[model samples]
Target: MHDLIPFIPGSVNDVLGSLPFFLPEIYLTALFILVLITNLLFGRNSEKLCRIIACAGILLVIQRDYQQIQLLFMSGRLNGQFLFNEMLLLNRTAINFKFIIDALAFVLLLYFGWDNRLKSHPKGLSDLYTIVIGSVLGLHLMAMAVNLLSIYLAIEMVSIASYLMVTYRSENAFGTEAGLKYVLFGAASSAMMLYGISLLYGFTGSLNLFSGNLLPGLIQANPVAVSFSLVLVLVGIGFKLSFVPIHFWVPDVYEGASTPVTAWLSTLPKIAGFALLINFLRPFVYFEKWDGFDFKLALSIIGIITMIAGNFAAIMQRNVKRMLAYSSIGHTGFALMAIVTYNSTGIAALTFYLAVYGLANIGALALATYFANALDADDMNSYKGLGLKYPAASVCFVIVLVSLTGLPISAGFTGKVLVFSSVYGIYQQNHNLWLLLLMITGALTTVVSLFYYIKIPLNLFLKRTEFVKNTLIKSQNIIVLSIIISVLIVLLGVWPDFLFKLF
Candidate 1:
């Protein structure tokens, strides 16, 4: 206690220094509170106003962060600086992730605003916006956190918001059930993570995961104990990642939640979660050999299993949302493969893949939602005979699905190429057979995905079913958004360098 007293204030100057770097998060929190007040005072009429406010707030933060990002990357200020006494990182990588998440939040806000189903309860829209904005703030925290305590806090913040958002449609039984499942699983994972943290702290007597003491302490400890604690800790990160073993919650939550909500769930948490994941493993870089408890090899194996499970499971899904749920699980595995590259090149690849994946995912889910609302259907069977009737929507769906399948002339293909190349590079440098097998599994799964991914287009164009009604549903907004996303996907495909250079 006496020794800890001296570390309390953390050099007054350091506290002040952290403020400047922390502006983006502070700005977001202030915006959240301001919007909440406005939401309450103005009632239903302020729903759209609050959305506008939220979008403007995120855009402002992005613009400010962009300037800082440029400065950090260009000026070489990222020489391992820590903020708030090593509680958070101040680096280009964290800034890049926050930018991506903020940008994604803006897109999601637009989605929530324009979605007719979400708009059913006017007052509820305000609550949803508030929750989403709060979640974005949590994402900012997740992006920069370096300490175990910070990591747990950020995860809880985002998880709580996600739990509520999944059940936003409280009137729907499926939505309620999904929310319950998420809450229960999240609680159990959080408890396990906290216990793991306590054990690690007891061993190391420090909270920082990447600090000097962590590895030394772990190395000195009993191997079985260290590995057990690490596995328990990883449970928290894996749930957010929705990879194999911890992935049981994804399909149900995705299928039960509204499409726009599902879109957010599929993309944002995974992005932030992976960022935290990389930092968590940085301490393990001290290993002198690949003989025992190799985090990289373990993750590679998990990635292989995840890709196989996700793709195979997707094939059996009749519901489009559930299929995409499984598809996302597959992509999660693919992203994990890129992760084990664990270097600058791998970071670039992972970042690019996530950006492209986020855009493509939102587009695909938007199209699905549009179809269900427009035709009163969510099954592949209902999509029969849709191509001729709704040419634009069906065509856009084809483009999104094609990108997702990693086909030619699309961003997803380039993303896959980048990830596989990174994985292969690791295999070459280290001669890790696990990575070799992972690369092969990734390739095979991509082929298998084609069968399921194409089912939508197949049902729309080839299979014939009785056309229920020729009447049109006004889904111009969804179709237009989907088309925009497809265009971006193709443009990125043709010039992968564009996004690659940015990251």
Candidate 2:
């Protein structure tokens, strides 16, 4: 019986260790099921209940995970490796730093719950909450997934949820059109990615990323084939991230989808997509094992093109959501610079940047939703004179815009500086003139971005336009969350080390 007692405790510890790492997902799963039941049982009034339950579930996970962070760090619990046979491994770096369900997700959840734009839908709110929980769960998994199969499943899960969200208002033509575009593009990309994965698996006979033994034979066999497979895989990731050349669907989709859903779509998928990029590139960083490939060079070229294209395209946009969509593409390019570094500092910087970026984006979208509701407009011209009518929300908008432009005393600036410094460190070590040029171009684009990002404030505050009075139904909860996020952005910009230590 004494020996049995020891075995019982050991089994319990093993189960607890595996379970705690997945707390957020477990909460989400329960919320999804409960919301579905509430929708079926309570009918019309279930929307509010569903929303509250979803928000509560996410909050509970955040609170529990945060309390564990100190312990995780102290015991170096943040640095474990759990392998599910030969296919998947969950590591501390992937969970704590990469799979982070932190302030960013919390802020996004707040935005999702507070945005009244979603209330415009005729269907029960339960459906929206289910999709949100499921999609976010997929995003969290995507960030931690280290195998090709897991990656595909994660992306598809998010993609399907996104399609439903886009077409939620199926009575409208725009919604149907956006859904079709998304489904077609998403399906094609997934097929290509699957084919690429098959090729990779055939060449290497393994899918586990951290094992680091799958690529040598492929690299020696045919460089062109390997590069082709890499490009195919990136195509799927780019579809999710909406990077240049593959970004054709973004503007239309953003304009068509409900604002809150668009906001969620823009932030979460990009973060996970970048995480997957970092995971995919980890083995190739040293180049000692694979001497023939130039993965860094490929990434640098893609980053340059994505940034330039996104910024230039955004400059011509009239719709605010469309412009933000393009701006997201440009930000993806900026984040890629850190990925090019292929080191811990680079990964840490990327993680920090995404968190700040997600918060800023959610705040900006919240303000946009308010403006759309108040003025019934989404064009840049409609923002004229908003500063006078909706002063608080307008001010928040300006601050978010400044942060997006990478201006001083904002989280955006901190993110930019971190990526810049990390890339410079890499450049200094290698003396790579090409990277230096790309960095220079990125800086120049930052200035160019300022012109467009500030156009909202300029339109709102400085321009003289007709006073169009409209109902500005302010949600106190959303406003407070925005203010909090804005303050954090400025605080992190000033004292970045405090934020860096979290990673």
Candidate 3:
């Protein structure tokens, strides 16, 4: 019994040793608590205070993330350490993911209050800040999590935060309906994931993916059962990634939610989802002898199908948000191409691609807000002839769409090139059919994407409307942010190495 119990003092020492690596998460938790308390004490009066605190806290967290990178450099490149009794793994990849999440989150925190609809909520934006802080913490956890229990908890934390954000304006019936649908889909997926986790634990007698017992125990189990369990777990993650089949909730939710919340949904959670997926797949991909399932083949087919479905469906939509919603799903499929390679080059490309995609996606949506506020336009038809009146905003919108469409001299183009290069490199070595198919599908989808993306620019610059709105409502904040993002997209495109070196 004593041998089986092991030593308690050693575990305590291990936890104490892990604290330094966990400083970012600690600070995030502290920020979450501070924001919550501010919201409670001041209520509606705390909006500006909450935003200030949230943005400053994110900066602090980003600084800590940078420090973690320096520590990784000092320790030696690519080496990682498990923390909190092997519950989490800290590495260069995880740190990079956290940095991206925080960077985007900072933008989102500022944008939330800028939107007139969200700003006018009766309960105020203070609580929204608090919820975003909590979600950021979950995103950080998702990047580092190596334990099944930790993964599930991190995902649920983000999910619940998202549910609240989508329906922040409870006065809007559409928003309430979207929230209910999101909750329902999320609940079902989470339950499936929990059951899957339990099944995996039952088979392996452990919840840690990195533990010695997990792989060997899994290898000996019934292959059919193991595969079923893995698929169930993927369902939960798929919900966040919004891949086909599980992606049904995205169009409705994104359409109903405020523009800022739509930006948050399309970027932050999806970035974190990729990180989680990478962690989930690492063990199975790297294990020498385990061959119970073919992740490569499964992901490849899903990628091809997802890209086709998302892009084609996007063509039929005239509503700007719904179109972007489907476009995001298409982008999700394209990102999966990198994951299938499972190489260092592929991972680097993925990080860069996601960063660029997230920026452009956010910018595109911000422009939607700009048009909405200034012209009261929400669909493509209403955009006709407005380009001449709003030259700056219109040009910025064009640049963003170019980036999203992966056109030349934009970050999106560079990202696609890198993904193509990485996949081709893998194909050169193994000559795998799936790799070839992914590349082909990726290229075709890029072409298909052009049809819908071009619609906005055509309507803005080419199509003529008999009547144009001269009266405008000011939304300078959103317009400014969109212009900045457009510039970054162009800058990063010309100098891809700026991000490449970092990744």
- Candidate with maximal TM-score: 3
lDDT of 2 by residue, 1-503 (tens): 67688678766666666665566667768877887888888888887787777777777766755654554666575655443332334554555543354445555655655655667666656787778778877877777677888888989998999898888765368767987988898899999999988888878887766665467767766778887887888899889888777888888888788777778778888888887777677666654677755778877888899899888888998889889988998998888888888788888888888878887887888888877767676888988877877788888888888888899888898889888999999899999976897799789889988878888998999987866765766576766777887788788889988878867
Among the numbered candidates, top lDDT falls to 3
TM-score of each: 0.96, 0.91, 0.98
**lDDT on C-alpha atoms for all candidate structures:** 0.87, 0.78, 0.92
- lDDT tens digits by residue: candidate 1, 420-489: 8888887888888888888889999999999999999999999888646654466788877888888999
TM-score for candidate 1: 0.96
Ranked by TM-score, the better of candidates 1 and 3 is 3
Per-residue lDDT value at 429 in model 3:
97
Report the backbone clash tally of model 3: 0
Q: In candidate 2, residue 104 scores what lDDT?
A: 59
Model 2 quality (TM-score): 0.91
Q: Please state the error at residue 180 of candidate 2 in Å.
A: 1.3
Q: Predict model 2's lDDT versus the native.
A: 0.78
Considering lDDT, where higher is better, how would the candidates rank from best to worst? 3, 1, 2
By TM-score: ranked, best first: 3, 1, 2
